[model samples]
Target: MYIDPSKKPYPFCPGCSHSMVLDAIGRALEKIKADPRRTVLVSDIGCVGLSDKYFNVHTFHGLHGRSFTYSCGIKLANPDLLVFNLVGDGGCGIGGNHLINAARRNIGIKVLCFNNLNFGMTGGQHSVTTPFGGKTATTPSGSPEKPFDLAGLVSAAGGSFVARVKALDKEALDETIAKAFQHEGFAFVDIWEICTAYYMPANDYKKQQMDELIASYGFKTGILREEKGREYSRVLNSAVRFQTSDVRRQTSTTLTATKFSHTLQKDSIGIIVAGSAGMKVIFAAHTFGKAALSCGLHVSQKDDYPVTVQSGHSVSDIKISREKINYLGIDKPDAVLIISQDGLKEVTDILPKLDNGAVVVYDKNLQIPKTEAKLIPIDLHGLDKTVHATAMLAKYLTLNKFMPIEALRSAITAISKDKIRELNLKAFEFGTND
Candidate 1:
């Protein structure tokens, strides 16, 4: 069988009902003769995410609450694949709108939610699915809001099949999951997972207490709704026209020149400058980006700061690449410039990804700790930290012969105002001299 029965000793809390849920899912996969190569299981964040390591089939651990969205793309790309998404109540609750819309569109996918009534990973805080009067870590005084019928909501939103299952009822739960897999369109199954660790005693919810609480709130079990709905993949397959084997590939001979041609750099570099407000981090990124653009290099930059606007946090992510850059977000930068202690703290996590060989330039006066990246510290030189550090970085780049000196000079002259133009020119020369 493709599903591994011995995959656990599960990581769930002691007495957690997730084992039963996993059993039913495995049995369902067996009933359908699920092939490991054609199957992809997506796991949402929280306890359910642990299943990614347990599954024998191809799988991808998804962003918090976004497994279903990722599934849509995967299914759209290859309709023959069987994709299963496992989510916790918090995953669907925080991103409830995505759940309803996925059903409404009847995207070809099967989604199972382990509704334990709270965010399990974050200490059992009250989630959208938490029942009224159920107390959680956040809801110390019993919850006041009523929980929604997750199955009914999906059905009404246009899911082709919707069911509710109890973890304890293995035979029936397995049968229900099998039928959901057989459905041709969107399928949603809500499985009850008991939170044995915190929820049980926090709300005085023992086995019998759970029965009464659920009954009082009126949640149903078994198939709640089953009907035909439009399958997004089926419709898309019929609508799309493309050659199955004869694919057209782009070639330089067939390509046209873009206006950004001259700005294209032979090689690329990424830099992130961060610090508090009034440090001119943005100015530094702009100066460098403009210089790269002048050389016909593709440049992308992003800035982030706090609401205080005067002195909190600031970050600028810049990428200068020869190829047409696609994703804009910077993960591991080639270089990082620190202007203040606040900036260093802001990107502490990112600094670890930097290679031991990566360049790290900072203001020496900050007196921050050392790092693995090649450290280049500069004196403030009675000039703005932003300008000084930028000049230092430029000097390093120039020494390494990264870009043309003529290009950098032209950019500095064009960007700087009449008053500061001479000062910036002098600074550029100072950087090379050092």
Candidate 2:
């Protein structure tokens, strides 16, 4: 029997799912009587790196999004010992092509994908798992794209065993982990955890939201069973040949709107510059895009990666012109919404190059450059003093008379009706009026 390390407790932030996954894996090991010295736990960058320091078992921390490749190598060399991988949604989803190819090869390793809906380790940025309309530091407006369902992806990618279980569901989760270990081939388990600080709402709002999600979706653990045979061996061999090409094709599909010229001409479009507020802008843009499409408007988007996390110049540009727009125009914003101090500093560049046509909206505290465009300054900081929710702040901006208030409200309601109504009604009212 292997001794549990006294320092086994990993240094993950409160509300993270890594601890539960580690415990479940450890319990699974105990159930199977696996020796710690022989077991190798491999993880990629981010919170999984902490596993190297915390777990008493032999551990390996690989490059960002390369945990599975390393696990493949380790298991291929030492086929007798057990190999496990602990990875986050960002690590898995970002490197999804490689992971799925690894699965198809029937690599003898167990994978615990900590699918906390978004990237927790990177300060709650929007990830491939971040559901549509979910808020994060990168997407203050809300995430625009829908999250990737790991179970379905892995299952279709030829994983011998695949499951999706909630982190809060201890019994079901524990059972899923045990079963994954028992499966004689590659196994994948996705653990859904909450990011309370970065991605989720505040304390009171989160509790209510959690209750609602539990009541609605409940907890689920999916399992796919595949017997080992000649067919399986044939499949594995063929997978290795297509792995590289398949991955390249999948990577080609990721959202790639880089230049301003590509983003601006939509009947109603929302552009999100990548970084701290990228999540928010994407959510808002997607919402507006849907509303516009429903109203028979062609929506296009422009997006670019930000230079850094805080204190850098960033912009989320949306073009809502009725006319057709094929070229990107940063200076022609219809009505701008500024969330961060960085946004305010870079407002001049965001203005549409048009003369006396665009509207500039920002917090009164920001120093709007003296320009030819009409400026609408709202006291958001003062409004925030009364309403603490970021969702509320977003809604307040959505209700401005200059923009499509009703459509934006409809988008917010469609995504998070209860939270929008309960948390931001008062703030929205005050900001709209004040």
Candidate 3:
């Protein structure tokens, strides 16, 4: 049984069409004899999201409206798995872009959108698919917005298969869902349903009313569109080929033979490189991570910056260890490199809490917060502000005895282009000499 015996008595409200839809999905999966282990049920926040636990198959419940995006990633990463997204009309509206793009790409994912016409779980608020002139909690008199013809929209967006079926028609729902599961490319089924708790009481809606409403909107029922096309992952795989030997030869040619003789004082070392967005702080941290990797140490690096491009503070957290690094987060950094006032402000709260004996390297011009860690100041009067992160990193590595300076030089050479490489190397030299 696809449904877990332990999770019997599904959580949907009595007379809720979601329960019927869930049963239809289970029956469809059984009819196709789909492998539960290879099947994934993706859902977002709503009445639909509550259905995952009742199914024994692999499941993912994410933020409202992001189910399609997650399902796309799963399908692209491993195309053999059968992926299905059970989302509500609210989710459809919130993630409309993802839905359209998924259809355009024609990825092999079955989307069963529960079109109940309202945000049933949150309130009886009208949704994107709510029929025009339909009364809802938010639309007391009637909805001003026109409902989306999901089948038509998906068909126009290049979906290989599209269907619209009433949730109460058990036989048709089962057959349509099974067909969607069998489709080779993107398949979308707009499952018309009624919210027993909210939508029904508000509009006195029922199965008969649903049919009339759909007809009035000029929306077609049954299989609306079906056409064969190359599936997205298959096409992508066929177009790209990896030349491993050439890649290995290129990597070997660029990397220098630099050895590390010093050992880490702790089991793992955390380092933070903070600067303004355009200052290459992330790049410098990545280069440092590569340098540590070349010394046979496990490394992980994470970067943070504002959505506004090249205009705000940028920070990167790096972890290096003799053992494999499991978690990338750095609760307390062993070394901190601050290159600008923006960066100083970003890490001000963290400085005072640093562990004793930790090292901090900062621009000599910036006033630093109180900290118990060892402090080293470097003057950046002659170098470009963009390379300040590189210089500061070099100085920290030199003083902290984390890795040999030659490793940093090798990384700079391997990662940077002609002029950038020259500038970075010069910055490295300045840091080491200063």
Candidate 4:
């Protein structure tokens, strides 16, 4: 009854062993008393993924072999939440690296993989663990390679808990699932399900002979491994919050402030600042947007950064408009700030689309090509590009009398720390005087 059968009817093949796995998960959730709102179920594209709707939990079905990747983010965003990944053999077969790495990272998550010995989502086909010498749609002559060892891989990869449960053993599977759910670090459960619609009938496999079938292959059941390890989130929190005791907040009564809200005008602008990631370009954009919010103006800011977080060029796109800004993206940005050669390259990529009067702010150190857009160049001298660029941009806005100096200052003060606030205020003064 926990499952909303009216809105999300159970959709599984007749006699499919996947239902047992679903029941185990439901029982585990019930036993743990997990909050429906705080529990996220990320599943892959297969019969297992179909179970996503069966539960009232917030669920997302992702790419064929990357449900765990999505779950990683879900857990990271809300570390207090209980996250589970439901994937199939196809996901594990192709996502072995992801699985191993997630284990090694000891992410605080539970992973349930329905291992039906073949790709059960599709017709009976050779999957990541297709029997080495068994027949399937893709391997009519039988699999020549060795079937993957999912359990051993997770155990060796550093999962805090690992288990292989037979689908038919409902009590054992549910208990193991509950344990996995309670684990502090990464927990993996490999449930061997029979594909009644495909894999079962492919070899004339009968439901009555399942015990014999399991015995022949030495199929595993119950908790295979369990250990205690520092969870990824716990370790990360310790590192992030270390020596940060001064961040406690004051009483809401003392923090409260009166507000006069006003809408933005049609001439509202979009500004982009681009440079290397470590240069604080994203933070600068965030500061500016937050400042604009303090001014009773509408604003939105977005950042683009590569995987490395340090070496690659970064971009912060900000929009400020008077009226309800219909669109956040600014294809024809009103202004741009380029801090390095890498930033200039990104600017050039969209140079042709810039409007006739759009402005370009660049580092004087770079050999920027001439353009019809108004050019404002600054010398970095190895100084922070955020401070210098924000100063210059704020000065331009104040001089044009389009934006208020007090509003900008109030914003800067509202969001910045002591040293940073003092430095930025001085920078604003310098730009205003310049």
Candidate 5:
């Protein structure tokens, strides 16, 4: 069975219309004979999201309103797999842009939107799809906004298939969903439902009045639009074939060979280089990582900085090891390089946690926090601030004899161009001489 029987007693409010929709989905999948291993059920946050556990197929529970985006990625990555997204009216409103774009792209993904006329999961607030004059927790006097006709919107947005069906209509719900599953391109089904816990009590709703309410809102039931078109993935693959081959050829021509002449004393080492923005901190760390790679070592580098692009502290955490590195985070770094006041402030807490044998390299003008690690003060004030990171890293490597100076020079040559290359090489020479 597509739905796991072991997960019996699905979580839903008594008399909730969502339960009916879930059952319809399972029945439709069975009718299509879809393979559970190749089928993916992507769900957004809300009362409907709780249905993921009941499905035995591959499932992804993601952030609210993002189920369509995730489903699109999965479908594009492997067009052979069947991808389905379960979203609520609240999700439809929040992710309205994604909804229209998904339809416009004509990607092969089926969307089943549970429309209960309100934000049922979050205290029954008025949602983008809430009917005009509908009573909700946030709209006690009735909502002023006109509800969205999801089927019509998707149809206009270029969806290959679109339909609207009542959740309680057993035969129609099952038939509509099955047809959507069989469609080759983007398909959407708007399932009209009721929120028993919030929307029902507020509106004094009855199951018998569902048809009348749909008519009063000017919504039509059954298939609204259907057409044949080329799927998005196939079109993209055909368009990019030549460009992809050109990129591969251009990449292969730039590669160079080098020999290793240095050995690391430890199995692994974690290093942090901290500096201000525009100091090329990340670039220096990447160059250092390449030098380590030339010495036949594995390397990983992660960079951090404030959202304000050019006016904050910047740091690079680098891992170099003889063995393959899995995790990138470093709790206690073996070496820390601080080159600016901003960099000093960023690493204050980290300095106190360093072990006794660890090294803390910083500019001579800066006051450092107390730490058990050995401190090495350097005269970096005379050099260009942008080159301070490379200079400090060079000094550390030269002192430990962990890597040959020639390897760093080659890396700087390979990574930098024009006047910047000359400056970086001079900085490396200064660090070694000092």
Candidate 6:
């Protein structure tokens, strides 16, 4: 449906499926002839927020985990306007608490979630919808835990109308979008879009794979009607059913999958770190750690942590051989530097849960853990260490042989020489490297 010249190119990364999903939304809008003046789009973080710049309709990038809440407010204030939620799986799934509460209240809003299966904005990290064994920047070793089924979860949460569509199926996507918009109460359409940037063999390879899949598989489109005796009927009815009680089951915390997983990783350590700052951590790995594999070492970051949006806690790390640990001990960290009491707590809790011991380094004087390991203190109290943190850490690694001098120097020089010298001596003089 996206004609060659009609397709507008933006700053989207190569192979991103967001443009396709956006096209489908536009087509559905055209088919329905929905009044753009009477429509307000509420979106959360990530590329979806870019809708404000792309579309002529009113759009708002709501706070994390609060898209539906904002949409609910918009609809309640001006019942004439059609409220559409353009969000990612993380925005609606990981940010699902607000979404469900809104649905239970029968907020007259429609949610169009582009389920790209992983985070797209801050590099490709895993989301709640990331399929098991899928590869991502965060899940290089593949995802360990399974993905949550979003359609079933919406149905269970009493969504009025819920349907699943794919980016590859334009007709189905168009139909699904129309049905979701036509619904009376809270409606959800899960757009299973592909992250061409993250989850595919190159574009050519993926095109072939897509061709094969399309050749073998058949797709059908229809509206999911709530049955008479079904508990999910409060939404599509003539009136809003604000009868939501303590129906908060264990399922509320669970992330559900709406389609088969499309992950492809076959390694150990199916670890799923957070995103946001975690993106930097993963970038550091790709920039530094991938070379470690040449030395016959292995590493992988997976997707199996908290959050369900395009942006949140940034996370990334790698699994390495304990046999050649230069800095961090193979069994436990030789020393764990505490940026705050929270870091101290995170390490201490894990020490009790792991087979090793860690020397806790604290900035602020705090009660040390009562364990056999030593507790070293460092006074980084008033150091302006943010800009030079990586270089300083690199210098420490160089001094301790945690990394090769050449590699550490390369990473530091990537910053600046003055920076390297200043922070290196600062860290060494303060004995923060201990």
Candidate that scores best on TM-score: 5
Which ten residues in a row are the worst by lDDT in model 6?
A: 254-263
Put down candidate 2 lDDT per residue, 61-146, tens digits, no spaces.
Answer: 88878888888888766666688888888899767877998778777688888776667777778888776677777777877886
**Each prediction's whole-model lDDT (CA):** 0.77, 0.62, 0.88, 0.76, 0.89, 0.57
lDDT of 6 by residue, 330-395 (tens): 234343334434334445554443323434334545565655644444455555434222322333
TM-score, model 2 to reference: 0.50
Compute the lDDT of residue 396 as modeled in candidate 5: 86
Any runs in candidate 4 off by more than 4 Å, and if so which? 4-10, 206-220, 237-267, 270-329, 333-434
Task: Compose the digit string of candidate 5's lDDT tens values, residues 1-434.
Answer: 98888896778889889999999999999999999999999999899899899998999999888999999999887888999999999998899999999999999899999999888888899998877787998999998888888888888999999999989889999999999999999999999898998888888876767788888877788988888999996677667877888766754443213356667888889999999999999989988888877777778999999999699899999998888999998877999999989899899999989988899989999999899999999998678888999999999888777778888888888864778888788889888888
Q: List the candidate numbers ranked by TM-score, top first.
A: 5, 3, 4, 1, 2, 6
Error of 4 at 253 (Å): 19
- Per residue, candidate 1 scores C-alpha lDDT tens digits across 16-122 of 87767886788888898888899888889998788776778899887888888889889888888888789998898866888889899898799999888888887
Ranking according to lDDT, highest score first:
5, 3, 1, 4, 2, 6
Candidate 6 lDDT at 17 equals: 76
RMSD of each predicted structure = 10.3, 22.5, 4.5, 6.5, 4.2, 23.3
Candidate 3 CA-lDDT value: 0.88
- What are the per-model numbers of colliding residue pairs? 6, 17, 0, 2, 0, 22
* Candidate 3 colliding pairs, count: 0
How high is each candidate's TM-score?
0.57, 0.50, 0.76, 0.67, 0.80, 0.48
Q: How many pairs of residues in model 2 come into backbone collision?
A: 17
Consecutive 10-residue window with the lowest summed lDDT within model 5: 250-259
Instruction: Score candidate 6 by lDDT.
Output: 0.57
